[model samples]
Target: MNLVENLVVFAHGKESGPWGTKITHLAETARGRGFEVMSPDYSHTHDPRERVAQLLALAPTAKRLVLVGSSMGGYVSAQACATLKPQALFLMAPALYFTGWDEEPQGVPALCSVVHGWHDDIVPMERGLRFAKSNHATLHVLNSDHGLNDQLAALALLFGDFLDQVKTEIL
Candidate 1:
């Protein structure tokens, strides 16, 4: 019997690239936990729906799937979850319920976690809270900004713990 390896796909923010600082760090953490990782580049379009389509098309099938997103990418990941049906989701400062996006974010993975910055100027903390509350996702509100660049180390630790929990649950 062929066993498909676990997969982790990362969706970068509107302004960040696929291998930005946070993604690079968290990808390493995921890798250390024996999971395959991929970050699709959505730099071509600023449209969230387009980004979601790109993710849906590119994400490969795996025995266990984990989707991670930041800022607008978080919205893309959540939207893709409707079709992908990933096992887990990790979002950082996700841009949900913002202007210009017509559809409300949907799809709830079995395990969902969010890390939001209290000082986020781009996406308000309240928006993150609302998303977390509605989805019943684990939330971590940090003392940082929208980028959460200053909390990279803490993010790595949190992501590692999250991945461990996912591993345990899937087993």
Candidate 2:
């Protein structure tokens, strides 16, 4: 895979910290592959809109960016994507059905990939599938739950593949 030097920002779920399991593992994986990853702590707010604002505020203005949003953070990332227009969007069990947030995203990144767990009770896989279909994003249905802890290996692989795809597309 070609090495990408873009700034990768990871947004954790509502109840998760910046150092959550998935984010931490992905950050390590990204770093090993020569990526600069940033996980901002948005554990303070459960509100998706507020978290979206927080993420947008922390987003870098000068470099290429890839936004990885998990669960509620997925919703936040999608919302932030309107403004940041990152090079790519990687979503994990994205919560696209939050009330009052009802607009199909516009100006999406060049590459959008969403991975949803088949066993996720918090946000059903069907919902994610519908969202992915609507947004025309590549979807990966893994055998896991809402937290997707059981599929870390698969997630890591997906993340790496996404980086390579983005790098290939941009370069």
Top TM-score: which candidate number? 1
Q: What is the Cα-based TM-score of model 1?
A: 0.95
Where in model 2 is the C-alpha error above 4 Å?
1-5
Task: Kindly report which residue stretches of model 1 are placed more than 4 angstroms away from their true locations once superposed.
Answer: 1-3
lDDT of 1: 0.89
lDDT of 2 by residue, 45-136 (tens): 77778988887787554345888889988888888888988888999998887568766666677589999998998988987888788878
lDDT of 1 by residue, 37-62 (tens): 99999999999989998988885678
Per-model CA lDDT versus the true structure: 0.89, 0.83
TM-score of each model, paired residue for residue = 0.95, 0.92
Instruction: Report the poorest 10 consecutive residues by lDDT, candidate 1.
Output: 98-107
CA error at residue 25 for candidate 2, angstroms:
0.6
Pull out the clashing pairs in model 1. none
